[model samples]
Target: MSAELSGTEPNRTEPNGAELNGAQLDLALAELGEGSERWASTTLAARADLLARTGACVAAEAKRWVTAASRAKGLHKSSPLIGEEWLTGPYGVLTSLTALRRTLRAIDGGHSTLASRRFGRAPDGRVTVAVLPLNRYDGLLLHGFRAEAWLRPGVTAAQARDRAGLGQLTPTTNGGVGLVLGAGNISSIAPLDVLYELVAHNRVSILKLNPTFDGLLPVYRAAFAPLIEAGLLRIVTGGADVGGYLAHHPGISHVHITGSAATHDAIVFGGSRTDAPRFTKPISSELGGVSPIIVLPGRWSARDLRYQAEHVATMRLHNGGYNCIAGQVLVLSATWPQKAAFLEAVAVALAAAPTRRAWYPGSDGRMRAARTAYPAARLLPGGRLLVAVADSATPAASWSTDDILTTEYFAPVLGVVELQGSGQAYLDAAVETVNRDFLGTLGANILGLPSSIRRLGPGFEQAMARLRYGTIAINAWTGVGFLSAAAPWGAFPGHTMDNVQSGIGVVHNALLLDDVERTVVRGPFRPFPRSIAHGEWALLPKPPWFVSARSGALTARLLTEFAARPSARKLPRILAAAFRA
Candidate 1:
């Protein structure tokens, strides 16, 4: 019943001989181009109201949204992971919409300040903006969690202050049309990207849906009716032919896509090397890459081992391992005494976790390819998680040199590689390995105890500066950066279309800063009450977003409603539902 195997015909017509398809594309582009100026001239207060309305519309349609997503992913209506669809699908999108609305309202009131507070500065002069705990609500909901965005080096406090409302600094006298190629994996990506283009960049957008999830076209149209009615947005459905036509269209002034690096190259450059570039429009992309998690060498109790083990498992297993920021490799200290115990704990967590359908396209083929490259990989029961260990002295024999290092498995398969060294030496070596050997400059994770972090103090801070990822999470999953609408999310700065690694531009930056290096988020290894590692009681319930949680669907729905309109009366019910999970 997977999408690939399903016999259902595509909701949109194929481009073989469909004249209507070309006409529809032309109409959408023309409307977007014509409406650009009107949308650009709208006042901040008016725009904020529109965004709020859109968020309310999405909140009201939450059930329909999750139902459609669940059916597409081949999950039963009663499945626990139905909440996955709720949280990642509509809930995440609503969060972004609400955040954007708040920013616009602040601008309207002549307070063009970001929700994050300035925390610290890196040695290289990049300022760190703590973007989480946006308000008392966030502090109450997600305790002990913090996220920050590191401004590009050389950006001073004066420049940061002046750049607060960069996106809305000047009205677009003659606005242009933008083409948005939607991502198939996450349902929120398309709508959220469209919001950025229209609200932040001052451009009207034409959103082309990926064929795999074209069924959501109706739902999107309903949710985004305000924009559509304003003639500032249009949604279309088709395959690569449709995408190519829209990309090369004369009306498209700029393009933003969320897909593979190959697709970006094909769009920016020509299909063949000998062919000249067909579309010269400026393009920005967020593509997949091999992400890594570095575990610093440290003394640990059994509590730390089990806690971090589940943490690593959750990072890799979430979303069926289809996330671009999912941890692909585990970098460990070869000399650490507890390395073996930690690995065993991770194995146990992976085995105990629930299994999800390998729903994404080409996942089976990619899994087979990874198995071929690493013959010794251990396939856990039910074939959900693949654990591979690589130990070699020479660089050529090391997993770091294998194609798997650069290749994004996009499945629930994780590779473990141990590097020789201890303390700062191991940390430095690990940083160098990911920076030089890893393929894309997307995101990376670092895990360590407070003592270990302190031991490497200055060295640890320097290591954070050295890593070339767009997002870094210490003792936290980088996915938080992706979900934090206020934080700028993209590849590291300075990538051209010719050699695009992760991507060329950034998005989800509610602050509207133009020059952004990366976002760094940190969380405590163990938060209040009892540590899950110590087998004591936990202060927080298992995250409702986890696929294994039985009450995921109900908890996610309640949480989304609360986010839309916070009510003290709703807290007890939400907490009770979360605890049941």
Candidate 2:
């Protein structure tokens, strides 16, 4: 049964392998012998081959994988249904492989096509690309759209090495086993993190499943069997005690987690202050945060406001608001005429949005905590409680940096803070709030119209420069950008050995050891209707038929088809079915 709202302990379950008792810990550590050397000797072509096969295996068994994943998370079978889009979802892994393969061929021939804009080019000439779904509609809307990225050579890599303070590539003297505590909410985060370590930093990782979804280990094991055979990865299961044992185990080298800060402190400082830190090894974590969404006012049509309002609300409503990267803050200019309309649109969206199953153990407690603070908070009468906090106060004093602001609710709670000032003032205040006020730095979002950008002028540029976040999504929700894989995923720029809010380094985009600080940016599109905004895709209860558009699954399918030539004739039927759905 679920816990009560006011007074209930966290639901802790002990699945198999909780203790990390004997052989499990030892075998995983043994696999990590001389880390980078083991990885370096393995050529990128070979590595690509392994990942490609894994993708093929995943696609072949996409239905089984999705069912298992959904079951493990206690989601209805209807949710995240495997189809052409969801199965292939949007990150074109095949395209990424083709790009990587081409880049490798170029490297062999002493020339490269990486500098081309067909991929994407950042302001600094970084080989940046955007990853979206395989569907045509999304393709048309995201005018500057690029596919998922995969390569070791990019202008961004060069910049990261030069100005980003990224240290020299250092090989490990004594390879230590690393633990990857997977987030239960997202199916792809686990595989992506493990891949980063194996390919980039050259580390062997034992993936520890979150208790909420320990039942799917069998499926993941089979799907990732290649990495297992390569001696680069392992997947384990259990609850808190298992995690504790693994964290303290001397065999473990570093640890990477995607959960709450409380979990991090518990592992790092030990559950009790008196006890020693859980692990003496290096630990890097991307804990949850109250990610902000800055809506920059711009040339308006009532259509733009309505579209964006729904877009913003969808981010919070996705996964029943379980994502660590969910948009929590709505930063808007009070002077903007459309602000009120946008808010109303959001409310309407929330009202119409379907309720999701709130199965996580302590969800009630988190929901109540948010509600007690904001009495007038609107609660959707359904499965999960979606708390909406609208703030109109100006002095900033009215905003208390309490649990709602500093801590991540991990529930469906939306907080709107209306800043009364010029465009520049709002940008400056938003940046300051993110830097000084919030406790996390995993992800952030900015919703600005073209007019807003023109109005802010240098102030907008200055604000973008000042904002400290790993994934600073310009106009879309931060969640979409993070999952793109083409974009580097990590802490904002300027983070280093001492400061690590956005995280210690980058993981996705195949950039390991990146020296990225504020990933300042822009997204020209106001709001997208057919987006995986709130985790739900294109107005569907379950994911759309084109599920592959959302990153992991999508990347896997594309790579599979690219590797094994499926008939081109079938492509039309698949596309037709997806869009029609």
Candidate 3:
């Protein structure tokens, strides 16, 4: 039964792991170990069929899935805030499955889907593949947003297509079992990792659920029954002890984790650097870091300041500020005449945003630490903490030395840092500051008006090319990149295990392109109605992801159903809901 529809939710409990004893754990791992080889040889047709069936299962469980996740985050069934859970939880998973299924079906039909899409060359001649607007639905829903997965330097278009779907055409003949240490913050990440391991890498997987997400274990089990029934995957729940056991177990051939750098190091070196013990099995991770929301200075009116200010607030406060990519640092131009006004508007917007429970464990402690670090920290009406730093020509060194600038506070705590310049000079300096000072390489966002962006011209492109972050969003939150299945999500490449800033490798590259460097997603500065007046053609208004959207709950629900089984008939209601927003 649909909890939201029935006005009833399941009996809930505090987050607790379902830890297995040594024998039971060994049995589960052994089953996956034995099934790995068989999975490697599974025909593409069989794999596609499994994905198809899994989509059906996910749709069947979508309502319960979103309901449990919503209540877990302290949202009542009728609260508008439940919309966040719907979009990021089951909707994210369903859309990913839909995209992957399309990719596989294309491969089975003897064609590379990437080859059929529009491709462009960067200023440096690197190939950039469009990931969004995959069809009319994308074009209609996300209207103005477009994303491109930029390939690394020297990757030719033909070679890019040639390297895609690595193990699909010719399956791997190796014996392997993969361990995925799933992220706790987002409900979709764990299952998405399992799908990537099975379909992209040809490895059977054991997914270890983070204890914070223990409540959703049953939901995941129901949605991913296809893999479980096939013996290609095992889902387990436990604290750090069991995760360590699985990571160190010799039978686990490879490991993929979406977690913190400390956890990754502890697993690889067994928490001891004195002996220099190295556990060498293949490992890839998507560890998050302190992401900056860089705001470029522009001549603007009160409306523009308030609009962008609300956008800034949304960038930080979305998901109750629990997302890995939530913007932490607000980078502004010290010389811009409107800097103070913009800051004031941001304060008002944050204060006015609706309050939600600080649901994530330890969020209160984290916010307390941040407040303690900066005496200037002040709590807004909605309990959002904003800490302001003094302007400087080089704020990176002085600010970076402080823990507030270097740390990833996964809470509703945003800090403001002003750099000394404007226009092209400011753009270059801002990019340099975030790249040099920020702790993680996960994501960064830049916002600029049409006029300012046009004036900067090539300097903007050059700056984007130099940004070392994994995902870059221009006038959009990087969370957009995270939700897009076609976009490659992870840290920028070339981090060593010893200095794993944001960890290594990428996931969610449904195009299956090799040597992916980063994902660049761009969006209009304003939404529809306003966008029309501003000459930006985006048809969306107050996107469903926005916490302020009036129709977010219903629109998100429609999007989930549309992804599960899209139809032309469904577009009208989705659009109607969005237009109301």
Candidate 4:
């Protein structure tokens, strides 16, 4: 019944859509369509003001918003994972809003300014723009991490500079309505998707909340009140029929979704073989894929082995391994002497990590399928991490040919496949393997020692250039690219609706670059102070994102607040909260 009571329940009933039928859906779309033209013509100053107001509103409701998310996901009030709710919920939404507002303000002043520095050109002629170290604060917080977005080839620096704010550069009088099918897993996905539609495409949007998290409709409404008042956005909740009606509605001009490829196919080509198409509107999506992590052969010290093992474990176990960008497959050098040792280290790290609630929908079925497919798969004691090692000799075996490579488990299972080779040979073959065998082209990771990287030299850069994924992280999780608002996050630039690998297009591109190909994020081989890996750094506490941390919620809250309004006075408290973990 009440919102407060709903939070305490482990699971809430899905909202019924019996009343969200044809007439109501038609009226909503009509209103959105009418408002789109006004939104398109609205002054940049006004748009910036609206976004600023929305960001403030989100910050004010941060606590209540995270509480609702944590409760629905069965996280205890004191659970460390409550920090995840904060990070992925209001914090994400506010960040996007603030970034968009800043961009708008810059554009309004007759010049577009982006926090991007050109990092030379790739072998393929694509210009690489390093977009991280976005500001002084980011440089301080992220330290050695840097993210770069590579533009499509044939576009000159002049052209990119001119097209930085394409939405503002090319204003159209004929704007239309867009339908956003929100995601269920992450609390911020829905609102952020809506923001993209409004800011990037100049479209007014009606966001249909997923049935799994429809209970937060009130929170979304409050945060987006300004947009709702301006008639540029609307938030609604309903089931399958509502989605069907909205998708096929004639008044809707475009559709955007953040869900599975199956859902996207069903919307575009109808649910069954015999049925006709349900929606002919232009559709875009950000779907899940079996992301892979390639580890090159190198001479790693004991500390390197342990640190990287923990890093890989963190990538796999974050958010209970429900993230779309989670590392699903581990590609290793079969001939490397330390292959077995590395695998053992990874298993040890995973086992030592804390267990998390399997709160995502269909997690049980997915985990069961993984286990059945690989009968010998090792299930860690807590039933959280599943490790399946494929036989390198039997390339045709079920373990190699099974759904593990093709399907996104969407659970805490990391499949390991070892390939033959050692140095440059290994890197070349590994890149080819991931390009051809990986399920989707959304995100990928490559982990190699600094010496190994330098030894490969041009070969290493060439290997990175050859990867087809939209986002590639070297010595880091691809999730970093997703969080960088300046970096475009999507599948590779070219994908038709017929064979959409990791959905159709990009989002979170605050610079509004239309010709983005992919984003590459590189982090240090080891963190600062070298000995920090052994828990010796005073300034940098264990990452609050680690599931094993105890003060995750408090740390997340402090971080969000600091990002919203940076102050030297608050750094001490933030570090204190982090150390408390």
* Cα error, candidate 1, residue 105 (Å): 1.8
What TM-score, to 2 decimals, does candidate 1 have?
0.92
lDDT of 1: 0.78
lDDT of 4 by residue, 1-581 (tens): 32111211122233543355456666777777778878877888998998988888888778888888877778788767788888788877776787788788877888755534555687678787767766666676666678888888887777777788866665554548888999888898888888888888888899989877877877888878889888898777766666766776667789898988877776776654334444557888999798899998888888788878888887888877889898988899878888888988888888877676788889999888888877888878667545556646856344545587889888889888878778998888888877787788999999987777888898888888899999999988887787776778888867766676789888888777768889999877666556354333323445666666678789889878876666889887887787776
Candidate with best lDDT: 3
Looking at model 3, report the run of 10 residues with the lowest lDDT sum: 1-10
How well is each residue in 311-360 modelled by candidate 1, as lDDT tens digits? 88878877778888888899988778898899898888787777767888
Off by over 4 Å in 3: 1-19, 274-277, 393-396
Q: Judge candidate 1 at residue 109 and give its lDDT.
A: 76
TM-score of every candidate relative to the true structure:
0.92, 0.78, 0.95, 0.92
For residue 542, give model 1's deviation from the true position in Å: 3.8
User: Lowest-lDDT window of 10 residues in candidate 4?
Assistant: 3-12
The weakest ten consecutive residues by lDDT in model 2 span 1-10
Residues 1-581 of candidate 2: C-alpha lDDT, one tens digit per residue: 11111112223433543545446555566665544346556654565566677666655654566666556545564443232223222233333333333333333343322333234444333444333432343343233333433222344644433321111133233244678988777666777777655544556788888866676677677767777877777787666766766666666778888776666666665544433543457877666677888877655666666666666765776656777777887777777777777877777666665555676668888888877877777665553333444345545665646566776788777777766665777678778876777767777788775555767776675566566666677655666555454456666544432344545556655322243343333443532343343222233211231222233233334434533344556454434333433
- The residue ranges of model 2 lying beyond 4 angstroms of the native Cα positions read 1-20, 31-41, 79-143, 146-176, 273-279, 383-394, 493-502, 511-513, 518-581
CA lDDT, every model vs. true structure: 0.78, 0.56, 0.83, 0.78
lDDT of 2 at 24: 54
Candidate 3 residue lDDT tens string, 223-305: 99988988888888766766777776777889999988877777777666535538688788888899999998988878888
